[model samples]
Target: MSSIGTGYDLGLFFSPDGRLFQAEYAYKAVENGSTCIGIKCQDGVILALEKIVISKLLKPRANPRIGSVGRHIGIATTGFIPDGKHIVKRARDEANSWRDNYGSAVPGPVMADRLGNYVQLFTCYSSVRPFGVMSFVAAYDDLGPHLYMIEPNGVYWGYNGISAGKGRQIARNELEKLDFSTLKMKDAVKEAARIIYATHDEEHNKEHEIEMTWVGEETNGIHTAVPDDLLQEAEAYARRTVEGGEDEDVPMNE
Candidate 1:
């Protein structure tokens, strides 16, 4: 059944088999996937995550891993890592397409919206299978900061802010305390760092560092990884809250 849609383009229609947005892959045992937190701001979006990768036997990988896209969209993924990488690639591809179609100089907000729309379509393609990848997509939208929580099922929810992985519950709880609607950009970053740090401490985990990405008017499509010094400061702050800090002093910037 095809229905005409008015407003923008009427040349698009959805098909089940044409695009299956489902995760049909086996889950491999891995040590760490990703720990991420996002903050929605008036100017832009802030996202942070710790990368922990494990070998086939569930042992931590020797080299640290950091997943980024187009230097603008920062994706900290959880769940199926390989799938996460695939998702990142998919996002990058969409970003490139938007650049090619609209112009090489697409705005950050436009890029974020394009990514979100792509994720939705991907989900539709997957149908009702199992999706192994889930990620926190934080970027700037025309209205300001745009945050989205993307699941493997292709179901994405626009959010003021979101966090993923082991420490998400702790981060979410902490985010509730802050007035996100009126919070400043700097405050949002610090809060995200604080919650992630607290989340690691509450779990008695050894991983201490949190990765971050920010998109704003100045930054445009250029996403900068958090500096090492700043992550150390955030870790110190998170440590004070709980007794005996055991979180590793890994550099947040990878």
Candidate 2:
């Protein structure tokens, strides 16, 4: 018989049932489930998450997966990707239905609120049980980027910026230096990668995966940056200030 532990509040979501949580769970493997950061820039909101992916049942790695659940809103995730995909699929389908009926994309903030509600429901019934998952949902609306933590029980809170997976402490340390309110989309993406790269272990041979989506007044649509381009930009930004290749502090003046 499989012994599932009691419900734990490690953050991603609360589990009503107790079960044996893995090391990743002990560390609250749920990325943004613990802390999130958000910056409302002049152009729009920039939301970022730690690049680590961890769980008791999963291996350690960097998985940057983000998407637009609605036409105008985007979500950046830092947790069990399968669950994130599950949530995204449902959200996207619902958004599409709304668009078909309304003839326009649903607003970003509204999409986030709806998604958050769904997460809450998921947590209530699923978090503490086996095969539970945690997630970070970063969204944008008229205001800017809004960050949140979604548990298996279906509860989530809107936050600014957050880190998940492994080495988030290192990521958070880097995030502390930024003035989020003035950040622009371009600079925000660069900084997001810079922080993650800084915290990642170079000894490990793994694909440096990252995905960024921008939505706001200028480009209120979702656009995925090429990994190579993003790396080049991130390196250049770091070179400006640091003695190394780039400074990583290039401000978005726009």
Candidate 3:
């Protein structure tokens, strides 16, 4: 008989080898979700996601994977969308509470820590299961651009560039070659689009759309969706880079 079922029945129980099967399962859910990316550059932070379009009748941009939490903070999530939405709501609440108590917007690290604690609680109790989602939080604060990734296990970390979900490995490789200290927001947007386009699996994910948002100096530190004109331009550039076999020479400065 397999020992898989011996201790995997409950999230609160630990297997003989000390593995938390429930949390691992939650991570699998995230791995199966659409790809989401976050990058912190000199001028600002960018959040992007490849949204899998399930139906032709569905309205465009109806189910966005990226959302703004506060004036300067944005979140991109991948996994069970409902679970992701729950986290988004909690983040928004935390931001509002912080502003009410401190008379200023909540910082990125503080928000990530609070959310990490909240998510970690579910893994410790038997009554509730872990949240099936991984999220990236991006913000532009007084200290400059910040990017953080929160996992289903409640662990979180600050990153210059990070990617989650199906195409994470490919996206990570692409991000590793960039010079973040000099990377501008415009180039970051194009890079984001290129990464998403490169990672999309046509056989598995037939139809998809790119969702990108940013908080930067140009926007006066306000979080907002990438404008339609710029978004279209980035999409065009990304298509050329991916389809033209110019992956090795992606334009970083231009």
Candidate 4:
């Protein structure tokens, strides 16, 4: 018998096999999304997203995949972008609430935890569907730079490096080979660009753009878009590495 109309129809119910089918579907949605990568460097954190261009006529920069929370935190998302934006709005609200109540910027871990709880709420009620998105939150706080990934199921975890979407497995394998202890932030940026390029499926024949952001000493601990010159340089390097078959080479500091 097909279980399509049974427990899978609602996020509030679980199937006999101890699975939340709705949540699993939400995860599948994320897996099919555009790729996003997060790397925690010695001095800071990096967030990168592959923005698929649906139409050439679409205004450039009309929709950004990355957003800021307060002054110090930045978030990047994969999966349904509208759902991601909703989560961004909630994150900003939470940051504002924390600052208003405590007279301080919200910490990275606290922001991630609150957002996780908020996303999880959707799965608990029959009135709402699970968010079809996964988010990466990056921040530089008193404890230092932090990187976290929040899943659709409401779980979030701190990671040295993480990837989501269609190219996650390839991106993760590349991320694992890096030694962050000695890796500089600039190198991390180049590496982020490189991994994105490496994971791209040329056969898919889709137009795409790279969007990156960081929170670190270079930005004075503020979350902001990567500078155009630097970003362009990283993209160029990525292309060269991928085409020249030089994947093992580490980026040298300029």
lDDT of each: 0.57, 0.54, 0.90, 0.91
Q: Could you estimate the TM-score for every candidate? A: 0.67, 0.66, 0.94, 0.95
Which structure among the candidates has the greatest TM-score?
4
lDDT of 2 by residue, 97-192 (tens): 778989876765556567667655533443433223445554455555555655554556654555655666776677677776676667776676
Please list the residue runs of candidate 1 whose C-alpha ends up more than 4 Å from where it truly belongs after superposition.
Answer: 1-33, 52-67, 104-129, 201-205, 217-221, 243-254
Clash list (residue pairs), candidate 3:
none
Instruction: For model 4, state the Cα shift of residue 8 in Å.
Output: 4.1
Tens digit per residue, CA lDDT, model 4, 44-149: 9999998888899988656788999999999998998899999999999999999999999999999999999999998888888999999999999989999999
> Which window of ten consecutive residues has the lowest lDDT sum in model 3?
245-254
Lowest lDDT 10-residue stretch of candidate 4: 1-10
Better of 2 and 3 by lDDT: 3
Residues 1-254, candidate 3, lDDT per residue (tens digit)? 24487557565777777778999899999999989999899999999999888889989877777889988999888999999999999999999999999999999999999999999998999999999999899998899999999999999999999999999999999999899999889888999999999899978747889999999896899999988788888888898888895564555433
Which order, best to worst by TM-score?
Answer: 4, 3, 1, 2
Candidate 1 per-residue lDDT, tens place, 145-228, comes to 667776654457777777666666676787777777776665566666667656664344344345566776546645666556
Q: Which has the greatest lDDT?
A: 4
Point out where model 3 deviates above 4 Å. 1-3, 245-254
Better of 3 and 4 by lDDT: 4
Distance from true location, Cα of 158 in model 3, Å: 0.4
Clash pairs of candidate 1? 19-125, 20-125, 20-126, 21-125, 21-126, 21-127, 22-126, 123-154, 206-248
